[model samples]
Target: MNIPDPQTFTDPEKLRKLMANAVRLGYEDLAFNCKLRIAEIAGAAQDDVIEREFWTALIAAEEFKAAAAGKTSRLAKIRTKHRRVGAQRLLADMMMEEAVSDGFETLVAHGRAELTCEAIVLRHEDQFSVDAVNAARKKLMDHGVAMTDIAA
Candidate 1:
């Protein structure tokens, strides 16, 4: 049996294989949607290769958030703060990219609440307060999506 290398996060083929392995291990719902999202970004022009790494890290950050929200009390609290910090760092790094910045703006203008909320937070990290992000979210919800949807 060939074990996949663990340091291949930015490689599309390796990431796809890892995601497939996750589904085979009974994580289909979680892995499949993420895979599709990644695939969307991966299909972009070759010069847009940076999207793959950024999106992958973004997905990992989301997973960390989900894990932190687990029902098991002890497990939920264990290192959750650290995990959250890690997730935030990952997102902050992603926000530095031009494509992610543009995509985030588009998401806030047209994407679903879940994604918009994340984009808002990513776009206004240390410069904004939690309440500020909340206020932006509320504004977006009130305005409703009216922007052109950008294909991934």
Candidate 2:
């Protein structure tokens, strides 16, 4: 499935159409990934309202399609059980360490830091808080890394 560009997310009509196509194609995972990507983008944009709406609508569509097909919602399967306190912090720390060890400086130089951070957060969404992700992105920016240097 062709994923809509992140820049087009600001257009509700376009986003809705893209999601509908995903649902029709039985690409629930694609829809979910789009939601995760949007979450990262929305956090960067400081637009929680649109993110929440997008999240709700996408989940609903996925659920509806799953019900019609007599299958469980992929979203339900992806949600992890609640974790112990500090577990998320540990995961965030490990992720940061791995990023640094992977030559994050080079990634920043190539204008990939922001997308890299978003990918990390989305890959471990259940184990990281939005605040932690935002802080990491901010730290990169504070070190003279431009978060908006590259288009995703």
Candidate with maximal lDDT: 2
- Candidate 2, residues 1-152, lDDT tens digits: the string is 45556355764445556656776888765554554444444345434432333233334344344435556444332123112323234336534552442223434543445334333444345556676666566556566765455234
Misplaced by over 4 Å in model 1 are: 1-8, 28-118, 125-135, 139-152
Best by TM-score: 2
The alpha-carbon deviation from the true structure for residue 29 of candidate 2, after best TM-score superposition, in angstroms, is: 34
TM values, all candidates: 0.27, 0.29
What lDDT would each prediction earn against the true structure?
0.42, 0.46
For residues 1-152, write the lDDT of model 1, one tens digit per residue: 55444343556556556766766777655454554454344434234233333344334334433433542122232135336654344444333333333333433432333343344343544544555455444444445643232112
